[model samples]
Target: MDEECSAFIDRDGDFMEVMCCDYGFRSGASRMYQQENDGRIPKNAFQLGWDNFKSELRSLRQSIRFDDYSTISEANPPRTPMSRAAYSVGQAALDSLDAVDRALEAAQVLEPLRPRAVTLDGVTRDSESGSKLINNCAEIRSKLKQLKLSNKAMWDREHAREQSGRGVETPWLIKGVYLSLCLLLDFLYENRPIQRFWFLETVARMPYFSYISMLHLYESLGWWRAGAELRKIHFAEEWNELHHLQIMESLGGDQLWFDRFAAQHAAILYYWILLGLYVFSPRLAYNFSELIEYHAVDTYGEFVDANEELLKSLPPPLVAAVYYRSQDLYMFDSFQTSQPMQNPRRPSCKTLYDVFKNICDDEMEHVKTMKACQDETVSQDIITRREDGPRVGL
Candidate 1:
C-alpha cells in the first residue's frame, strides 16, 4: 500500500516523514515533532525545584527500567498499537512466541546449547543425549518460521536516494571508518536483518556513552561546567538506545554465540576509539557521529519498508511496550531536539512494525542532534537553557 503513495511532506516541514498504512499516506513524523519544552514535573513529584527533582527522578527511573522488568510487567498495558485484523494477527504472533520460550527451556539442560563457554563438565559421556538434544532442536526449528522482510525492490530504490550525494561530505579518516564498518556489517549480517539491527544498536549506544564520559571528565577537572544540561540529554539518549538493545535481545537477536561475542567486543573497541576522537576534537567527533547516524536512518528506513508485513503481524516486545507507553516520558522527549517546545512524541508500539518504525524515527532524531552539535552557532547554546538548540526533525 505504501508503494502506491507519494512521500508525505509536511507543509510546515517540522515533522518526520510518516508512511501510514490505511491512508497510503505519511503520518507519525508530524506527531513526533509536536513537542513542548515544559520543564515542570508532577506538582507533587518532590518538594525541591522541579528541574533538580526531575533530574534525580529520571536517573532513578532509568535504573528501575533496566534492573526491574518485574515491576514493569506488573504495570498496566498501554493502548494497543494496532486494531481489528492487524490486532488479531499480532495476538496470534504473540501466541506463537511461546514456542520460543519453550525451546529455550528445553535447551537449558544441554550445556552445549547454553551461551557460556564450554568446559570439561561431564563431556566425555552421553552421545545419545547429545543426539537427542540435536533432534529436539531440529524439531523445534521445523515448527517455527524465521521472520523475513519483503519488498526488496522498494528498499533498494529508497536506499539509492542515500547513495545520491545530498551535500554530505566527510573527511578521509571518517569516511574510511564508515566504509569499513559498512563492509564489516555486510560480511557479518548478510541476509539477517534482526541480528544486524542488534549489532547496530549495540554499537550505536557507544557514541553517546563516550560523549557523556568526556563531559563528566571535563566537569570533574573543572575544565567545563557548561555541559551539565548536555550531559543530561546525552544520558537520556543512551538510555533510549539501551531499551532498543533490550528489545532486539527479546526478539532473540543475540541467540548466536559468535554474534554476541563479536558485537560486545566491537562495542568496547568502538567506545575507546570514540572517546579518543572526542578528546582530540569534539567537532570531529560530532561530525563522525552525524555521518554514522545519518546512515543508520537510511538503514532502518530500508528495513521498515522491506519488512512491513511480517513486522505488523508480530506483537511488540515487553520492553518496547514499557518504554513507549511509560508514564515517565520525559526521557523520551528530551532526546528529540527537533520537535516543537510544546508537543512531545508519543509513538505507538503495538506491533514489531511500529517498534522498528519508531526506532527509525529515533535515529533521525539522533542525526538531527549530531548535526546540531557540528554547527558552530548551534554548539554554543546546545548545553544552555535556550529554546533554539537545533531545528531538526524527520
Candidate 2:
C-alpha cells in the first residue's frame, strides 16, 4: 500500500508533493490501527467505546483514501520514520473527537425548548442535601476562579521572560511584514496558540515552495543549476512545515471556516510575494524566511515552556513517536543546516512537550538554512541531502 501511494505521488509534480504525502501518511497511520486485534481492547465499556472509535477512524480513512481530491499529488511519499508523525495520529484522533462533537451538536439541536432541573434520588430543594449542594457548588466556583487567576499570572510572567531576547532584527520592510502578521494573528487568534501555530505553518510552507519554483524556473531557463541540492533541502523544510500544519489541523486549528479561508488565502498571497522577492533578490527572500523561522522558533519555545505541565500530560502522537523513534533519520537530518557534518540531530519525542521542543528545534534548523542561503558562498556540501537517491530532477 505504501509503495502504491508513493508511486502515485511520484507521478505528480512537485506542487502536489506536500498534499499527497500528507494523505499517504494519514492513511498509513489509520491502517496501523485497523490491523490491531479486538483482544487489544479491554472488556470495560469505556474501552469498547475507544475500540469503536478506532474502527470509525479506519472507515473514514478508507473512504477518504480513494477520493480524487485526496489522491492529487505526486512526490515520493515520506517514509515510515518521517517528521511530524504526531500529525498522522493526531488526524485520526481529531476525527474521532469531531464525531463526538457532531453527536453533541445533534443532541443540542434536539433538546427541549426549556430546561428543567432534576432532583437527586434522596434530595429535595428545601432539604439539607440541597443546601450542601449549593455550598459545594460555590466552593467549586471559587477554586476554578483561583485556578484561572493563577494560570493567567504564570503565563504573563513566563511570556515576558521568554520575550527578553527572542526577536531577530530584519530589514524594515521585512520587519513591517512580520509585525503586521503578528498583530493580525493576535487579533484573529487571541489566546489560541494552536490555531495561531496552524495559521503560521500554513503560510510557512509557502516560502519554500516559492523558493523551489524560482529555482526550477532558473534551471529551466539554463540560467542557474548550482541550487539543485538547495531545492531538496527546501522541500525537506517545506515537508517539516507540512507536518506542523497537519498537527495544528488535528488540534482543531482549522475548525472555523473563516480561519481556513484566511489561512489558504494568506498562503497563496505569501507564495506569490515570496516568489517575486526571490526573483528580484534571493538574499531578500532568504532573509525574510530567516525572520519568520526565527520567530517560529521563539514562539514554539515559549509555548512549550509556558504550557509544559499541560503538554506533558498528553501522550505523544503516534506519528511523532514513529518520526523521532524510528531508525531512519535521513529526512530528519536533511533540513538541519547548522548541525556539524559528522554530528546529526537525534531529538526525542517521548511526550507532547518533546514534540513541541523538536518542532522548535526544526524551525531553528530552518533559520540556519535560510541564513546559509543568504551567504554567497554556501556550498552544496553544507546543505544536507539523502545518500540513497536524488529527491528531484531538473
Candidate 3:
C-alpha cells in the first residue's frame, strides 16, 4: 500500500508541476497552502483600488456583451458605425484610465500602511485561486463522470437510508427544519456534487461558532465558567469544518458567485439560529448538531463509496495534506471525545479518497461528541492536552 501510494503521488506530480507554472503555488490545488513572501513589496492602496475598479468594469462589460468580444479587432469590425464608435471611445477611455492609474501608482501617493510582504494564510487570498482550483476540479469531475458516478444516485441512496431507519429522534420542528434544508440542498445542487459539499461545509461550522459564542457569553455574564473546555473542543470542531470548507473551495466548490452568496448568507442565518437554541436549551442545540453531523457522515460515506476509484485517482488537495499530515494535531485530537485520549485519529491524505474518508470519520466523531454533550456526559470524556497528556474534562 505504501509503495502504491508513492507511485500515485509520483504519477500526479508531473501534472501538478506543469500546472503550478501557469497558476502560481498560491493558486489552484495548492491555493490554500500558506504563502511566504520573502522580499516582495505589497501592493499600494491606489494599485489595489485601480485593479478592483478594472475588474468591476470587465465584469460589467462581460455582462453587457453576451458574445465573445475577442474576435472583434482591427481586422474584423463592429457591424454598425455607431457601435464601432462606441467601442473605440470605450477602448480609448480605458487606455487613458490605465495610464492615469499607472502614473498614480508610480507617484506612490497612497502607499499601503504595511509595505513589507507578509505570509498570506487565508485560503482565498489570491483572486485567481477559485478559477484555478476549478480547473483542477474539472479534471477530477471528468474522471468521476467516466466512472459513471451520479449525484442523483448518491442522493437517492442517502434518502433511502434515512427512510429505512429513524436516525435521530428530535422535536417535530427541528426534524422539519432538517428535512427542509436537506431537500433544498438536493434541489439547488442537483448535479453539482462538489458545490453541494461546499455548501454543507460552509454551514457546518456555524453550529460550533454559535456554541462557542453562547458559552463565551455565559462566562462573560458570570453565569458559568465550566464551559472553557467545551469551548476549546468546539473551536477544534469549527477549525476542522473550516478545513473541510477550504478543501471544497480548492476543488472549485465555490467558483460560482451565486453559490458563494447563498452559502454565506445561509451560514450566517444558521449561526444565529444555533445561538438561539443554545441560549434556550444547550441539550437541544447539541441534539440539532448531532442530527446534522450524522447526516454529513452518511452523505460523505455514500459519496466515497460511489466514486471510490475516481477519487483515489485524484491527488489530495494541498489543504487536506497540510491539515491531516501536520505535525501539530492537538486541535484534531481535542474534538474526538469518544476515543481514548491516548488513541487519536491520525488519518492519511495520500489521495482525494482518503481525504473524504477522513472527513466522513470526523463527522462520526462529531456525532459522538454531540450526543455526549446532550447527555451531559461530555464533561467526563478525557481531554487530551499536548503537554499534559490525558485528563478528564469537558
Candidate 4:
C-alpha cells in the first residue's frame, strides 16, 4: 500500500516522476500484451487493466480514445491509460448489470468510525478534533465516488454500440483510455479507507482496504501486487462468522491472490505498527518511531524494483495511481531521515510515528529500485556503445 501519508503527500515531485515512469512503462507492457493477444483485449486490466479485467476486453484501438477527456474532474483527476480503460469498462459492465442502482457494489458511502483515540492507538481527542477527522474521512469517500462514476462513463462512451470507428486514432484510444482511466480512478477512490470515495460495501472496509485495492490494481494492470486478504467478501465483527486460514494469514481464504508475496506482505509493517498502537498501552513517542523505522528499512525496500517496466507503463486510468505510489515513496524516504522512529505523542508511543516511517521506508526502497533499474538501462547503453565501437579498436 502506502508507506506514510504525510511523506507521500510532500514528495509529490518524486512521486510524480515514478508515477509517470510507471504509466509509460505499463502502457508499453499493456500494448505488448495486447499485441501478443493479437489485439483483442482481456476481461481484467492487468499489466494493462490488471485489477479489473473488464477494461481490456475491447479492441486495441481503445488505448487512444480520450478526445474530450478534459471535462472530468474529481480529487485525483484521471491521469493514466489504465484509468481510462477501466473507466470505460466500468461503464459497460456496471451499466450492463441487472442490479439495482442503489444496490450496486461499484461504490457506496461508509459511515465514519469515531476513533476513541486521536490516533488508532487508543488516545483521546477533543470533540472538535474528532469531528474534524470524521468529516475529513467522509469527504474522502465522496470524492472517490465521483471518480469511480466518471471512469464507468468513460469506458461506456468509447465502446458505445453505435460507433463505427475501426481505425486506432487518438479519438478512439482516448475513448477507451479515458474510460479505463475513470475506472482506475474509481478503484482508487473505493480502495482508499480514509480518503475520498470510500466505498462502504467494499471489503476495503478497514485497515486492509487500502492495501488490497492497491495490490489488486497493481496486479490487474500488471504493474505489481502485494498485501493481505480475508476469506470472504463479507465479514462480521467476531472472527468466527467466517472461515479463514487457521493461522491469521491468507492461506485458506476465498483464495485472495498476490502478485509478489514479498512486496505486498510488506504491509506487515503497517499491521505491526497498528498492533503496537491498538494492542499495547501508550508508551514513549520515540519507541513507536523506532518500530516504524525498523519495518520501513526492513520490508518496504523489498519492492522498489519489484516490477519495473510493468509499473512504468500503466494506462491512462492508472497513470496517477503510479504517480501517487512513487510520490508517497519519495516523501516517506525523506520523512524517515528527519524525525524517524521518534515519538508522535500528543498521543504517545513511537509506534504511531514509526508506522509512517515504515511506509516511507517502503516507498523509498521503490525509489531506489526504480533508479537502479534506470541506471541499469544507462549502463547497458554504455556497454552496447563499447561493443559497437571498432572491434577492439586499440
Candidate 5:
C-alpha cells in the first residue's frame, strides 16, 4: 500500500477527523484518543446520559425504518410470525443500546456538548474503502461456501491438529479452559468468519493487558522491578493487538450487539483470570498466553490460505495500512523478541491478504515472546536489546 493512501500517514488533519476516519465509526478511535490525550475533558453524567439518549433514539428510528430482520430467517428458517416479531423488537432494542454505548464512548473524546470543528472527508473516504473491502470479503465467502471451504471446515482442521498436539503441556485446568474457549468460538461463530476474528482479537489482547497490569502493580508496590522491560514488550503486544481489533472492526466485524457483548465480557473475564494466574505463577500465565497465541496463528494461517485470492483482490483497510507501514515502528519491533532488532520485519500491507498474513506473523512473534517468558529467557533478550542500544526505526 502507498503510505500516502493511508489516512493516518503524512496527513495534515484535525485530531477529530483522523480519529473518526482511522478508527472508523466504532469506539476504537475514542479509546485511542483517551489513551493519547490524558488530559481530555470529561463530560458530566447528565450531559453524557443526554447524548446517549439522543444517539439511541436516532439509532432506534433508523433500525425501525431500515432493518428487515433478514438474519432471523437465515439463522432460523422455520421461524413463526410471532417469533420473528419478537426477534425484531429484541434485536432493535439491543442495537439501540449498543449505539448509545458507542455514542457515549465517542463523547469521551469528541465532546458532544462542545462545538468542535470536525471534518468528514477522511471519514467518508475510509467508510467507502471499508465497505468495498467488506463486500469483496462477502463475495469471496460465498465462493468458499460453494466450494465447501467453510469456517467449520477450518475449525475441524484445527481441532484435529489440536488432538495431535506437538508439545507445551499445561495444567489440566488451563487445558480445560482453553479447550472450552475454542469450542465456544466454534459454536458461536460457525459461519461468521469476520465476527469470529473480531471476537478472537478482542480476547487475544487480554493476556498482555493482564501481564502489564500485574507488572505495573509489582513496580508500584516496590515488589519487583525486574520486569520493567517485559512490561514494555507486553504493552507493545497489546498495542499491536489493538490495531488488529480495529482492522476487524473496520471490516464490520462488530456490527452485531450480541457479538460485542459476548466478546467484551469474555475479554474482561479472561483478563482477570490471567491476572490471578500471573499472581500465582507467571510461568503458567505465560503458558496460557502461549496457547492462545498459537491458536491465533493457526486460525489466521488457515484464513489467509483459504481466502488468499479474494483477500488479494480487496484493498487493505486504512487502519491496517497505517499500522503496518507507519513511520514509527518501535512498538512494532518491541514485541518481536525472536527477531533481531536490525532484521526487524517490514511487512507489506497492500491487500487484505497481506494484513492477515502480517497478523499471523505477529501472533507467531507473540508465541515466541510468551515462550521466552515461560522459560525466563525474555529478560536476557531485553538485556541484549538494551546493550545493542535503541534502533533508529522510530
Candidate 6:
C-alpha cells in the first residue's frame, strides 16, 4: 500500500504530458516530460499524481497533530533559519493535506490495504498452548481481528517527514513491542506451564518474526511493574492455594516461614515482568515506552542491580542456587536484544524462561533473608563477647 502511494506521487506530475506523448502533445522541450512510448498508466496518471500529492498533504496533517510545533513561530521558538524552514514546511504540509483531501477526492483509484504484519488477527489459535487455553486464545484472536488498524502500516505516517529530509524522530515501535510482550508475559503467568509452552509454540508458528520488532519496544518499561503485574495478576483471581498450601506445609508449620514464604513467592512472581516484556511478548503491538520506563527503570532496575551486588556478599553455597537464575536473566536480556528478532523467543525452552525468572526472584528473596541472618549472627556474636567481659586477656 505504501509503495503504491509513493509510486502514484512520484509519477503523477507528468500525467498529461505522458498521456499524449506518442501523438505529439508537445513538440520538443515538453516531450522530455512525456515518454514517447506508453511508459506508464496513461489515463491513470493525472488522478494518481493528484492522489499522491494528497497523501503527502495528509501525512503533514497527521504530524501537526502534535501541538509543540505550532507555538514555534508564535513563541519565537528556534529563531534559526533551519527551524524556521521546518516550521514553514510543516504548515505547508498541513495546508496541502486539507487542500488535497478535497481536491484529490476523485483522483485516488487504489484503496489502502492492510499492513502485512497485521495478519492472523495479530495472533493465532494457541492449540499449541494446549486445549485448555486454545479456546480462550482463539476468542482473543477473534476480538483483535476487528480491531486491526492501518495506523502502523509499514508506510506509517510517522516516517513521512523523513521522506522530506526532516530530522524528526520517527516514533519508535518499542512501545508496541513492549505491550505485546507484556500480554505474552501475562498469559504465561496466568496459565500453567503446559499452556504457556503451547502459546510460545503458537507464536513461533506465526508468519512474521516479531521478536526483534518488540525487543526495542520493551526495553523502556519500569523495572518492577512488569514483574509486579505478574505477581498481582495471578493473585487477582483466586490462586490454586494448592501451591501455597504445599509450600507452607513444607516449611514445618513455622509462621515466620510462612511470612518468608509469601514474600519469596511474591518476589518470584516479579520476574515474570521481565520475561513478558523482554522475552516472550509478540511484536504486532504498541504501547508507550514511557509507561514501561516509568514502571521499570528506577526501582526494579535498582533492585536487580543492588541484589546482584548483595548476592556477591553471600556464601557461595547460599548464592549458588539463585546465582544461576540471575545469570539466566542476564543471559535472557542479552539474548532478547540480539539481531533481527529482538527478544527472539526460543521455541522449545522459552516456556521455562518465565518460570526460571519466577524461581530467580524467589531465590533472591531467600538470599536476602540469608544475608540478614548472617548479619544477625555476627551481631549476636559481638554481643556475647561483650557479655563475656570483652576478651579480658586483650
Candidate 1 per-residue C-alpha lDDT over 153-173 given as tens digits, one digit per residue, 9 for 90 to 100: 434644686578543467998
In TM-score terms, candidate 1 sits at 0.60
Q: Rank the candidates by TM-score, best first.
A: 5, 3, 1, 2, 4, 6
1-394 in candidate 5: lDDT tens per residue?
A: 1112324442223211121222223644343423455467879999988986765455443433344244433544545888668767777786785576458757784233322223323232356665554444446444433211255666665677778974467999998988898889876766567778889999999999899899999999999988777888898999999989988887666765557668988999988989888999999999998888888887888888887887776666666766777676888888887787666798977667788999999998999999999888887888777666565221
Candidate 4, which segments miss by more than 4 Å at Cα? 1-127, 150-394
Worst 10 residues of 3 by lDDT: 1-10
User: Could you tally the backbone clashes for each prediction?
Assistant: 12, 6, 0, 110, 0, 26
Per-residue error at 147 for model 3, in Å?
A: 8.2
Segments of candidate 6 deviating more than 4 angstroms = 1-76, 105-277, 280-394
| TM-score per candidate | 0.60, 0.59, 0.68, 0.20, 0.72, 0.18
Clashing pairs in 5: none
Model 1 scores worst on lDDT over the 10 consecutive residues at: 22-31
Score candidate 1 by lDDT. Answer: 0.62
Cα deviation of 227, candidate 6, in Å:
10
Index of the highest-TM-score prediction = 5
Residues 1-394, candidate 2, lDDT per residue (tens digit)?
2211111111112111111122222233332222454235457898878986665444443333322112111111334564247446645765675565556547874222222223322334575656565454344323221211122443354457448964455789887997688668765654556657878999999999999999999999999988787887788888778777766664445544445568888999999999998888889989988888877776787777767776665544445555555565666766765665466677766556788899888898888788778874346445233332343232
- Residue 306's lDDT within candidate 4 is 30
Q: Between candidates 2 and 3, which one is better according to TM-score?
A: 3
Higher-ranked by TM-score: 4 or 6: 4
Encode model 3's per-residue lDDT on 304-389: one tens digit a residue.
89779788887776667767876667778878877775566777777788989999999999999999898888866743343336
The models' CA-based lDDT, in order, is 0.62, 0.61, 0.69, 0.28, 0.71, 0.29
lDDT for model 3: 0.69
**lDDT (C-alpha) at residue 352 in model 2:** 66
- Residue 352 displacement in candidate 4 (angstroms): 25
